[model samples]
Target: MVRDLDHALKHVSLRAPAPRFERPRPPRGVFTSQQGFMRALGVGAVLLVAVLPFMDASRYTMSIATSALIYVMLCMGLNVVVGYAGLLDLGYIAFFAVGAYISGIFTTVLGWPMWAALIATIVACVTAGIIIGAPTLRLRSDYLAIVTLGFGEIIRITANNLKITGGPSGIHGIPTWSFGPWSFDDGFNLFGIDFPERVVFYYFVAAVVIVVGVIGAGRLAKGRLGRAWKAVRDDEDAAEAMGINTYIAKISAYIIGAVWAGMAGQLMATHLSAISPNSFQFLYSALILMAVVLGGMGSTPGVIIGALFVSLAPELLRDFAEWRYLIFGVLLVVVMLFRPSGLWPATAVLPWLRRTRPTPPAFTEATAVPASVMESVDGTPTTDAHEGDRA
Candidate 1:
């Protein structure tokens, strides 16, 4: 039986595509390596953020930009769960709320510094991550999603009912980060230009935070942990057979994602100076998930772009009036139809531009046993007689 099984497996080619049909790959525009593409993208994002303030922009414009940055962070965090680990979490916003409320309580109730609130939020989020992931990570697909959705709603409802969270009105007067007398709350003059202190400083802070988040997420996605996540995501049984602890990998992904979301929530709380149950509805969860899908899952650049689109499309299309959402729906449908793998998928890789045939081996190997050679009964060549003839 063992011999038969090994023989049967040996004949099965490992290189075949899945039984399910996959969409045709889109053409690679110009990128040859992942590193080059990401570097270009990072530089462009930094340049764009740097120049936005100088562009005669209004307060509304700055607000939109700030919101977009927050969305980018959220989407990237979710990417770890959905994109890398292949987990379908419907209520990821629960962690966001967890972070926000924890940080809010820390700052307002305990009168701690913003940095302390940030650290406490991360710790709480990690604890929450373990609690939520322990049992649900054992489930798969829709079963997992249902539990997450329930968890999300539970968090929201609990916040609404709790007095410490300020009931439905939520918590306010959450303080922003400050260093002694110099605070983000205080505006100032720079390079002969008087800027609105809160707007400029806050925007700068958000941008820096987001930039760091993007880099950190990208780095994690490229490391050993990421490989384990991908292995489990592709096939849990196979991953286990290969000695990978699928459960641990899944839980680690959840925890890391939780940490990212928690930090973002801290920023969100600080950015808005308030927290309400209304702010963490299922609608926001759905939107963030949509952004992950619409942007190529597991692709950092794609996720960022997707986040920006989801966050800004409503405001950008407000001029279209009642037809705005309809138009937006149509556009999303078009993108799905045309680029189902996403506008830029993570799996895109450049083929070798130059192909070369393998070099030939040196003398000892015989080609076709050579027409002139004579063999003895045991298949040893008659070279002994040939040696005397040559001498």
Candidate 2:
């Protein structure tokens, strides 16, 4: 029986159509290949122009750049929460307040080092994240936003009434960020560039911090946790059904966002040598959220663009200071109406977007057979024999 089956299979193999695979053809035209080298070249040129003049720019310009960079960092952090996790946090400024207060207390009253203060600021912000995110995240969407908004106001009010936080007077004379020997207050000489010239040191520090934050956010977006966050963002119910712990994922997003905001707070405190409840107002929170949304929520580059627009648009329109906010509001509304995806939408477009592998030629019964009949055992021509031989 085995030998007969093998003989039948051999016959079938001989008569069956050949199976083959074909390679895919390259796409023609309308292609947008990633050019990282060219992108890097353009970015390098822009940075050189923007930064090389820092040693000579006026104090006002340097201050503006520093503030803009800080905003960029904050937006990236918030992007993780809103953009990645799809959580709308309205009181993000609360974390910034926590960081500034922690840094202020550690540096001014406790007489600890600035680095130590920064570390403590992060810890405090993380603690704040848990304390706030725990009970509040239990609520869905709009309610969560309201709770966060209330929490932010609560933080600001507490800071206003607390003595350690300097009450309404706020904290003053907060020390500059420093390492073992390099005091940020004493700006270093970059080649011939003096650190303190027009407060260039702050810009230098801010640039480093922004770069680090951007890189970290990008890394997080591509890591395992990032995928989970995105899964939750896309569909919380589905993600939960798939065994992802939505609660933990949401909490992680808040903690990361809080830490980022805290760092920005530290930068703000050092830049102004002060901390105030006014600094963490609802307007600032809205502004940061604006940067994230206007840029491209989940996109790092988009968020950077949004931050620059939010920060520099007002500065550039200083000549029209009377209508600056009006113009800004108009521009934002225009952007949302026309290009709702964002200034740079995260959608990736390219030629031949669909899979383009060559398909095998299908053979039918008539096509598979030659224009001839097969003979039976008696040598009489037979269509049945030919049909059977067609396999």
Candidate 3:
């Protein structure tokens, strides 16, 4: 019986496994990949911004544009915390307040140059970030958010009460950026096209800061630190097991975000030549967080769009007078309803840009079995019925 079984096994031939179905790849080209396309779009946007003042250098236009750029800076920073690290910060504006107030005090009270004041602002923001993040980052989700909210309120109240911060009235006459003898207030002529203080400030200072901030945030999101942030965001325990220090990742994100917000605050103070407790209210914090969510967290392009929409939508709808805010709220609700993941979610792909490929046919049981496998050692095909009868 053993010899007969061995003979039968020798007669049976095994077939190789079926080939795996591979999806067809799109043709390689400059715009074929998402990253390449985004790069091109970013270049175009920068160029457009460079020439925008030439089109309309009006005070109203520059003011609105500058404000939108400030929003962009703030949103980018918040994106690092909430979007990348998955830390919900409800009191982010506190860092902004810190930067503005510190700069204001250094320049106006201490009679320091804007450059010196800026250095102070950076240090103060970093310290504030550590103070707030060190204690609160241990808490996750809603608890973290609540603590941040309280911290924001504390900063506002402190500013309102402190005489150095000008009390409730806040600081005014904060000087524009300057380096020794040269100053932004002096303005400059380029290519025989003379520019005024407002134009020079908007073009050189605000635009440059915003561009640097955006690029810096984007770079950070693509580096090793960014990977750790994403890992911690996805699964803290898994990341910890993989040797990532979640605490350090969270704190780094918080600190970077604080510095970004602080720079924006300094810019704002110079733009308006003032800083008040009323400006850093809880409402502004909520608005900044909303912009991050609305634009799609963890997405650079989406965040920029969200910031612009949140900042410009009100002004665009101002023709409606008192009904503008109502319309704006309705629009936001409608957008969220339709695109819950965000208008441009991190995973989103345009239909037209998607790779086109025919669907492969599904596998079936009939195709799984080979004819040789059903044959007997005697060279006669054997069916289940025949085998059962013989048994």
Candidate 4:
């Protein structure tokens, strides 16, 4: 009996331990992952926009669509500052003004080509960004907002007074984009289909807004600088402690946003062939900011949706005439009351659309160790090997 017990003990000790239990991973399915779903959504949106002009082909329709696209570009740029960097910039339109004025002066006054004006616009916007951001970024919250608001007013007033900017009348006769002898005024032929000037311009704006405003900003948000921006936004002191230069991060975001707005301004200048002081008013800034907040800050899709809604809602509600503004305000209030975080916040998840995870197996007799194995030769309960090793 003693020999048999010894042999049993030896066999048990030498045997490999039962395989550790691991919760089974959820099965992968189409659109199961957030990244896959977002990618699909973005592609679908692009396809929809690309087909819209084909469906209507009307000047009125194209104009509205183009305007909406411009709004998207502007909002995306602002999204970088307000959404990603957590900065409340009330003067973002200043950059837009800078781009418009520069492009106008270059193309109209200096008699430079549209391409050259574009290059100058970019440089001016970058310089303006540094000037505004370097000094003001150190301030936080309400103070920063106030300072930015003042800056916006100052830019508008200065534009209104400047002779080159055409004072209150603003710059007029701003020419369309041209490359060498080819201009947007001359439409193109693609795949045997003749595209009109308006249609071509619409396509051009769509490409720029989607590529630079949407994709570029989205890529930036996923990069190292973007991470630093987020860290600073969450806690400036904590980010600094972690070796991040909070000032550099904040200013970089400001500068990138300025460049984006400047590009949008140039596009707008070409689209309208004119720009006015009234166009860059505080009200417009408020509307843009409202779009960002309504769409959910830090969310790219949400910002785009918000911009479209703000830009197109009035037209859609035109049947109400003068009461449209009141109705718009009421609707905005209702949305805020219901969804304070914006229509589609960054953390939002659709429960119905989400893939369900299988429940982990419950503990049972089969999973429990045998009483004999739990005890030592002297009959005292054996402590866990892992616990002993940890001790």
Candidate 5:
């Protein structure tokens, strides 16, 4: 029996041979080799903007770009609350209103410096975040959304009725921003192109701030805190078991989001040189949220593109006037229906961008032995030869 089994095993091994080459595979993670492509795309975008003045940098176009940049900032802020933390905050524009009102007061009424007013704006937004986020964050999903919506309305109404906010007339004649010897009202000639002083400076300023915010949000999303927030987003129970404080994480997301929005409001106040309660209406909040969703929630590039479309599309369709909004609504609905994940989904990368692929599986070595050793030295077989025979 042992001799017969040994012959059968050798025959099977000879018939089915293992591969000649075998090696362990490489580990997986976000690749650094693709950084060059990312950098190239970024450079290309900047170059396009730098050349915009050459192609009719009219006041209208520049102003549109400036407003689009502000919307980008707002969309990024909302992305933090909705995309990263998975919180639906419908009242985010309230923080913008608060910042505008607070800074407007310091600059217009008290005659404080614009820089000082900016500081006040930051404080007001942070305070508002804690005040609103602290209590509402304890609730889940729809309830939280409803509370935030209410908070937004309350802020708008308060601004409309308040004495300091200038009632319905709102604040006007707010001073232009300046830093030391440099003023936003100053213009310079470059490459034979004469740009408007105020518009050009704020355009660059808003662009810089938007870039910084994008980079900051990207870093935060990949950090330890970001992972914790994802944990809370994915499963609260599992995150709690893993020792995360979900409540604190949610509130922190709100505060960070609010700070970005406040800075955006400061930009707006300086750009318009005046602000009204009408500027911070519920519709504005809804619009910003729409930008975030349409751009691809949690994606920086997607959000920026989304913001530009939302802000600029209607302006470009000004000829249609009344019909423009109807067209806009239809476009959004179409986008949502077909590309529910947004135009540029957060998980997607350009085709030209190639990250390193995962390594292949390794081969294992198996020994081929004579069936004579299959016996336990007492005439019984140590192998499952009988089972194979039964099969």
Candidate 6:
């Protein structure tokens, strides 16, 4: 049988197969081509903000810039809950209010320094986030939004009824940040330029805080936690299948967002020297949410750009009067119509592309020619043989 099979195989002929194997490719760095461009844009923005106050910028200019920075920080915080974790929160302003209120209570009522008040504000925000998130994080879509909106209203209404919070009039006489003998309230002269008011110093301080917040948010968005948040955002069921605790991941995002918002609230309280229940309105929440969506969700640069536009567009178009908002609405519609997923979408890179070591496929299904295609006269099988003439 063996001889017959061998004889039959000898009659079959085919071209020799070529030797082949995959060559190892180096893993791509974390910074993709487009990401590099965004880095450049961020650096330029930082430099511009840093030098603006020194370039004969008017008081109004610094004031507007300061407000824009606050929005940027708020939008970035929202980016975590809405953008990264994919949670729908309509009452995010509640956290902002909580932070400001906590700081205000600590400073004006409790006689705590601004720095210490800031610490208390952060703790309170984080705690509030957990309390709210524990109950509502499981909800999805409109349900989540409605629940959060209710929670926000509950907070504001409660504040309005409380004497400690100073009722509807809110807290006042909030002091600027100070340490030891130094206070941000004091004016200073730098080089040939003299800052006559606290606005310039406040502008510098806000710039620094905003820059740090942006950097921190960006880092969080790039870390392991960030990936988990994105995973939950994409598909909670699938993410759970992959062993990710969607609930925990979601709450984590909420807490981070709350902390960021709280810090921003503290800044707002000090910057304006007061906090009112009216400031934490539903409209502000809507606007912050809009800024994140208008800019690219999950995109740091897009959020910043969106924030600047939202905060400054009103001032820039003031000449248009009431028509300005109509025009702005039209422009927003146009932008959304053109780029729906935002200006910069969060695209996932392949494992091999993002990791230091590329993972190989486990097993490949065989779909080619069968291993044994013919049987010899002696009842022995022969490997693939091309049809041909035989003696």
Among the numbered candidates, top TM-score falls to 4
Tens digit per residue, CA lDDT, model 1, 1-391? 5565455456543343233333444434336445566677678878888788788457787777787887888899999999999999999999999999999999999998888787899899999999999999999999999999999999999999999999999999988887777777676778998677556654665665556668788788889999999888899899999999999999999998898888888888988899999999999999999899998999988898889888999889999999999998898899989989987788754355234333443333222322123332234444544354558
Worst 10 residues of 4 by lDDT: 362-371
Candidate 4 per-residue C-alpha lDDT over 1-391 given as tens digits, one digit per residue, 9 for 90 to 100: 5665575476564434454565465544445656667788888999999998789999899999999999999999999999999999999899999998999999999899988988998999999999999999999999999999999999999999988789999888988888889998899999998898899999999999999999999899999999998898899899999999999999999999999999999999999999999999889899999999999999999999899999999988999999999999998999889989998887777564566675776442222433355463446676665556569
Worst 10 residues of 5 by lDDT: 25-34
Instruction: State residue 99's C-alpha deviation in candidate 1, in Å.
Output: 1.1
- The lowest-lDDT stretch of 10 consecutive residues in candidate 2 is 369-378
lDDT of 3 by residue, 79-195 (tens): 999999999999999999999999999999999998788889999999999999999999999999999999999999999998889998999899998877888889889899978
Q: Candidate 6, residue 388: CA error in Å?
A: 33
Give per-residue CA lDDT, model 6, range 1-391, as digits (tens). Answer: 6676567667655344432444445433335344555567677877887777777567788777777888888889999999999999999999999989999999998899999997898899989999999999889999999999999998899999999999999999998887888777676678876775555655665665556678888889889999999999999999999999999999999999999899888888877888889999999999898889988898887888888888999899999999999988888898899978776555633344456454563443333223342444445554543322221
Model 5 segments more than 4 A misplaced: 1-36, 189-194, 351-391
lDDT of each: 0.83, 0.80, 0.87, 0.88, 0.80, 0.82
Model 2, residue 165: what's the lDDT? 93
Give the alpha carbon lDDT tens digit for every residue of 259-317 in model 2: 99898888788878898888888998899999999999898778888998999998888
Model 2: residues with Cα > 4 Å off, grouped in runs: 1-32, 35-42, 45-56, 190-193, 197-200, 348-391
User: Which candidate would rank higher by TM-score, 1 or 6?
Assistant: 1
Question: Which of candidates 3 and 4 reaches a greater TM-score?
Answer: 4
Highest lDDT: which candidate? 4
RMSD of each: 9.2, 7.2, 8.1, 7.2, 8.6, 9.0
Q: How many clashing residue pairs, candidate 4?
A: 0
Error of 2 at 21 (Å): 5.9
Query: Which pairs clash in the backbone of model 3?
Result: none
Model 1 collision count:
1
